[model samples]
Target: MTNRSTAIPQLSWSDVCGRRLDRHGLSAPVRDGTPADAVAAMCGAHAQVLSAAEVSIGLRVAGATRADVADALWRERSLVKTFGPRGTVHLLPTRELPLWTGALSAIPPSSTTMPADARLTPDQTDEVIAAVAAALADAELTIDELSTEVVARTSPWAADPVVPAFGGRWPRWRQAMHLAAHRGALCFGPNRGRKVTYTSPRRWLPGLQPAPAADALAGLVRRYLHAYGPATPQQFAQWLSAPRRWATELFDSLASELEEVEVDGSPAWVRAGDTEPPPTPPHGVQLLPYFDAYTVGCHPRNRLFPGPAAQRALAGGQAGNFPVLLIDGTVAGVWHQRRSRRSLDVTVEPLTPLTVAERRELDDRVERLGQILEEKPQLTIGTVLVGGHA
Candidate 1:
């Protein structure tokens, strides 16, 4: 049973949004913060579309640019790109890798079953991972190079091209790539021309090791609550794409540190010290790019994507497929951007009528976006004809 009490604190949707946005650096952005600061605030930036991830972090830091983010990843080494939440490419703070690696490795495996011919058996998985770790320990290697090493180190079955991906088959050994990542055996290295490379975290972070699992997961839970609280274990599970039962038990293990609260009459939680209500709901316009941490992980989806937003901005009830327009903490519209040379063509379709001031704010925000992206932005206030993930 949960450590819930009758005296649970009550919060409205606005209260929840206000506090959450504040913690995410959305309500009051940080002018002095670095990309790492912004990245840690959002847990990590989803980077399937690296440029979009740059924008997501850049906008949260005043005067930050894509150059700054690139420097952090490649030069300063403050950020590490790896398979993160939901096993997607994400830019996580390097210093936090121990927490990330430990927690990720400890997660219960996904419930979805892969096809027999496409998946690795338990022994093969371990063998492939060991081969991967050995191959990347001292040098960076591309997936092809790693595959070659795996095939050499293991049996030819490790090289069997049986898994369908992106219209072609990937070698069976590639299936263990993420597993190797979670086990702290691999992470992204600098790109060679257009090809990606992988290196051992040991080589990259030197003397790096995952934190103890229980400690790391507890810290991750606390951090998640700090940013996205008045949230439930189910919501946390969705964010990490972790097993629901595992998430529930993890939260249960932290009952002493968490304070149960009531949000919009529904049960939720927050860090024990964060029981007080936040200042106020944020005002003005927010243009969030695809797969933004806020859009992807926020709870009470119906409220964030109220009415038309649910139909327009979300793909099958999942957010992050479309760039969103948030006004006063709720999704007010959808937007799209197309890059042209050094300029961006921005299209916005507002589901609600904007006041003259809101329109002006939007124009300023678009200009601000151009500043962050080092582009010239042209805004169209009418229809966004493009579909999601455009």
Candidate 2:
């Protein structure tokens, strides 16, 4: 989406970092907002590890703790856990679930999840989805419980062990689990003991369904642009794990509402009326958890993950594999944490030397992290040998 009629306004990389850090509540993270508001600001929190997702949201708000994020998900019912972007578990603002479901519904289905030989037929997939909805309408159920309910509701073939899992075979109907979540048939419920549970969304928000596709997609584009603008369609596509061509066409359709601009020479687009960069560049040290949305969603990877960060902060150029130490809105190092009964031990591997002031900032970040996690924190600056933070 370009307005090539006149000279395109140019934005510097530093300017982009400054604005993004400010919008993400990281530049001056001492702000006021609920956990759900923080989640909305970041589009959503990648929650494959629920604890990391809680910390991701908690860090964005002033004085917000993991408990606050948990309350929003379980008590207040203001945020929901479901299969979000890329069909990964995420904590999305409950109020925006309809928009998420709508846009996702409009997306063409991606590659199949299971092997071709073991995959369910189209009709069987539909039957499983319907059974899932019907079974979850009133009570929350674990995967095993839901499997039993689904098998009873559908054909016996639905329970056949076809899709291989953690050494064992998963029921054929289980292949449609993410599909059920994406279609708003169900969402994560409070854990029942050590097992996870799923329940229908209708229980909390009656009559909720996907919004009309066209309007919902437009709204989603605007929301995404608001959170991560001055981005390319390819970057947006990569973030959503959607096909590049679909993202390109979506950007083309919203041309009137977007403005193309030059960023360190490369072309990018922002919401039409928003072209000015933040007055101040990003500064200070902040620690980000695994799968933090900012690290996973930002574009122009070379700049966000530069030099040593390219090797330390990312896994083969893919962001979010390692928890990172962000200095001035860019990845600067990698970190690891170990929690005990009384305190959390944190080790940081800095790619760049830290100044006296930066060291103080790092200590402050560790203190705040301890507060959010409800543990005393001990910071160690040395080699971080973790192969996986998750």
Candidate 3:
């Protein structure tokens, strides 16, 4: 049972993006504006489900802690998930994992998208497992040693004319090691010089068999849309590295629970319900890291940022180079943050001049960010020059 009478309002992309930034405790306006909690009341609360190492990488790049990550894992806040989105891992919240993973499963993996070290015929994989089992029967092996032995045994296969010689890239072997570890045939010996060695499966997730494929895929999809929804099937497809056909199937599966809406004139799918959106703030400024899920979370990209600006921001893949500025509810431009001995320098390059109120609001945000950083409260922040205008 779903209702379509309510036309989903044109949510201010800026508002959603800015609030998202501050919710993560990045930056916010100086005035008596809405806090992240209030703004969460305007748009739906976003879940920080991560599937890839990249999601964590993005968070770490932004200075998040393991505690922050633990909060989102295996819960509604985050789904302990995995798949190829941007050819890396993505962590989605538990609630939304099913649909996104399902959509992702629908997409076939190309050679480029598949892990680098994945060269195993079923028989060869079996052989590798058997070899791994035999090797671990008496002693545990570190990833490096295990990988070395695996290469020796699998070298014959790697040399096959039909095979691509992807024996040592660390992808497939890692997958095999995880399987062996999961199978109780291996356990981790004390952390060996920054790497964990495996003993037998009984040593790790004892007695736990891998979940069914359908179950895993469905779970991934559900989490992705739940956390990053109000997105398009295309965006979902892109996020999952899935094909359009499979994405449609997953979307259709959740059709009753999803609503089609336009975000900034582009079609997007948002969770369906009467749940109130996050509240609006009088003024706002947020410093979002590069590849911040909040920034790349959208499919079309322009819904929250101007296309030109977003593209320019992504021109560089690194995070420290591009710090995003959210003013009001839209991306005003980029802010660059630098660290000094006792203070941090934040420089803003606004796409447009700030109004007197906006500037003051920005100053307050700078103060708050400094407090959070435990650095000097001084901003040392200024706007960038564009066409001789600051």
Candidate 4:
């Protein structure tokens, strides 16, 4: 731990970016040769959009393909897909699920978000959570099947409509499924045809158990600082989908293990002894997929994706709309891709002109993307809409 009287270092935007890139395993190719290493490096890969998660991991791990990621999840059991930080689907290393589950469960659920007509009583919620764990203990079941079991074990409340979505009603008790995942009780299994399935983590990973909530939360905060440090309490709260006051309290509790730092004039915290100047910026051009962890992990959106870059890279302030062109750890442009039987055409629109070297590096990264998808490359450079929508 750093001494209390240690002078805090002020980091430039470039320095912050350099350290983040290195920590995320993007400064150079990941030499570990395992998908779990890349996922673990970023804490976990954002997996709300499945294909985007595949591309995000493939870009960091050398020689990794989309199929390789799938194999690790389904066949190898080295990775598990579950609702993680911020209540979003994420691909987490199987061995680390306990820590994530315990930390996430520590956050009390918000009653404001629950619909009055479909809200479950506190006792009912507990019943549904237990039912979900039991129903999935030794079997893989689709949401429909699991819902049936939950209703049978709990009450009719589990099947009642909570709200309207996607031209259909969402049941109130479905919230328990999310809770079960956060409790380390359940995780996603392979798809059956077009339907998704859920299974018990205990069945999939024998002897797996969650650590104490306080210890797990501290560990999670330390890991977050390592990957996206110099972060404010609000930023940490946003990442975890918890209240700012809750996050601030958690941050204060860990002060003994953390040190203050300045980022672009804003005061933030990082792990103790991590106040050293960041390394020189890495040189390269890369395409980051939609919902990429690197893009989502960095905060203070105005700086990392400023003005036009933000408008193009993000949709209505959301960061997962389009694939982004990253130049020296900053968002410089946006891109989209279309695939044909014989070739893949990637359209790129740079907010500003790139240097000759940057353009060459861009091409190299494009070729690498092609290899990961098992498709031939065809480059098209121009302005394109977010998500490639017309």
Candidate 5:
């Protein structure tokens, strides 16, 4: 079929997000019995789900140790290349660097929270480039090793003791790597002691020249629609942090390719042709990570959490970084757990007064969340109802 004829489905933001993660190869399992594709599929029918986790809760999820978790996230992107998308750092896959960095080169850098004293001058940036090039001519090193090279190469007058600890000089070094990335001089390498290593990109992908800038941007637009389809250009622009002109240009380029849909009475664009519908999630409670893609990717928030309850649960958008209680599809409230002498104490604030059945069901769900976290959850239900913070 040229276009999907089914009615636009009422997918809870959480369910839609979960689907995205599964399709984009961002979910925990690295391989799901499929042969390893050269670089895992970064652009897929459900790309938003991956970016949601990568940008918010981070890419690594189910490893037994923190190091393993961090390593899994690190493989998504070298720390430097990760910052290009959304102009915010993301745990991107190493194989997909070109998709993001290529887009970064087209957008202007916006204001961000990089340490001020760490800023570098143009000449100093050049020095960093020379230093790192010398260090990695044939060698692959972790961020620490690369930082040492940068500190040593910096002039003694420019030296600051805090440079090592605070990376006062590291931004310049990071900039050099970005330059190297742009020139295809740096790329993903084998992991060294838990950190994803980087060597010359040219060396890593010898024949894989990047597509032209216009084509690359177009690819990003297409990928976003496929992954997080039924979205607005405004949403796409915010996700990429692109200028309005560039955003419009990219969308215009794909005029013939996308399909229009009315979601909740708002205009959206979904991919032109995916015949199979996404599977429905089993009804249950889900403890979403703070800043879970489900909450952050969509707009008008009401569709997911209902009313002021969303605001209370979010606590000034701070909720993105913490664990939350998902009752059915919407965020019914917020929850946090603390481990004690023998069990896990989970504090729950329900957005609305729950019926006896709902409370019991929620308790059971919290128990499952505790199981995932490897602890027995002792739930403490809050006295306050919806729209009030605990």
Candidate 6:
């Protein structure tokens, strides 16, 4: 059991949003330096869609190009791409891999919920995890190659089909891949042609040292609060893909370290001494790429993404399918882009009519996006399809 705090501070919704923008590196972009710096600021940028991850980081760092993000990951070795919170791929700073891995490993595996036929026995699962780590300890290998190695090291059981997915059977061993990544034993390497590859973080990231599990969990929670504070334990749990009880227990353990705050009359938590006034709302409009951290980090969908914006921007409550149009921090519409030869064409559809100024600002933002991609942009203002509606 842990001690709890009672003196909670009250803060407005706008204040929370403003502070989030500042903490998320949206108010003032981090100076162009390393992709690690940008990833660190955002806690970790969603990378399930690699291209979107590039754009997400590019939007927050001045003069950062997609190539720059790639260089940081593949060439400079400053960033490590791996499965993170919620079992989703994320790009994390190489130096912080230990913290992420330590915290992630602390979460008990949920494989027991899988149908018996689809689940690996506990001993089999452990063997598969160790085999994966050993195989990728020094070299990058594609899924097929890694699977072959696992079969050789463990058994045919390691390659047996666990369940059906994407119109085909997913092998039992496949689950171990996500497990390996979460434990920090494996991470994505640059694509080998059309096939993605994986490598060992221990071999790829030199001089890595993971903090103790408890310390790492505490640090991760604090970082989450800093980037997306005034948040509830349920929201935190949702973000981490952890059991509600586990999240609540972790929250209780840190009660003494966190300061209670009210978000729109609801209780939330922030880091102790994080009492600075919220900054002013950011000006102009922004076209946030798919799975942009800001869009995904702030929760309680009803609030951050309210009304028709929800129906249009999200598909079955799942984000990342379409890029979002951010007008003064809140999602206002959805957008898409296409490229042909030299010029890029962009289409934006706002839920409500925009003033001349807002339209102009939107255009400017699109132009900036073009600069980031190093291409000329052609703009088309129109309705964007969302939730099967136009």
Ranking by TM-score: 2, 1, 4, 6, 5, 3
RMSD (CA, angstroms), candidate 4: 2.0
Q: Kindly list the per-residue Cα lDDT of model 3 for residues 1-390, writing each as its tens digit.
A: 224688655654544444344444334322332222221211112222221222223222244333434444422233232322544433433333333333333345434444334455556656676667667665667866776666676655533333233563343544444344323244344446777565543232234344455665555555455555556676767654457776777677766777766556656666676223456552455555444555555444554566656654544432222456766545567766565896867777777777888788778666645644556645544554322101
| Candidate 2: regions farther than 4 A off | none
User: Taking the tens digit of each residue's C-alpha lDDT, what string does model 4 give over 18-106?
Assistant: 88888777778787768988898898998877878888899889889889999889888888999998788899999888898888899
Name the better of 2 and 6 by TM-score.
2
TM-score each candidate. Answer: 0.96, 0.97, 0.59, 0.95, 0.63, 0.94
TM-score of 1: 0.96
Q: Tell me model 3's lDDT, rounded to 2 decimals.
A: 0.49
CA lDDT, candidate 6, residue 343: 91
lDDT of each: 0.88, 0.88, 0.49, 0.84, 0.53, 0.81
Q: What is the lDDT of residue 20 in candidate 2?
A: 86
- Order of candidate numbers by lDDT, starting with the best: 1, 2, 4, 6, 5, 3
TM-score of 4: 0.95
lDDT of 5: 0.53
Clashing pairs in 6: none
TM-score pick, better of 1 and 6? 1
Regions of candidate 6 where Cα sits further than 4 Å from its true position: 1-7, 111-113, 207-209, 386-390
Residue-wise C-alpha lDDT for candidate 6, range 78-169, written one tens digit per residue: 89888988888899998898899888888866535678777777788789888998898888899889989989999887778766678887
lDDT string, candidate 2, 1-390, tens digits: 787776888999888888888888888764768888888889999999887897798788999989888889888999999999988899999898888888877777777667786888889988999999999999999988999999999999998899888989988888888888877898998899999999997775688898888888889888888888889898888988888999999999999988899998999998886888898878989899999998999888889999878877777778888999999988899898999897899999999899999999999999989999989999999999888543
Q: Which parts of model 5 have CA positions greater than 4 angstroms off?
A: 1-84, 87-89, 111-148, 151-212, 274-283, 315-319, 340-343, 355-368, 383-390
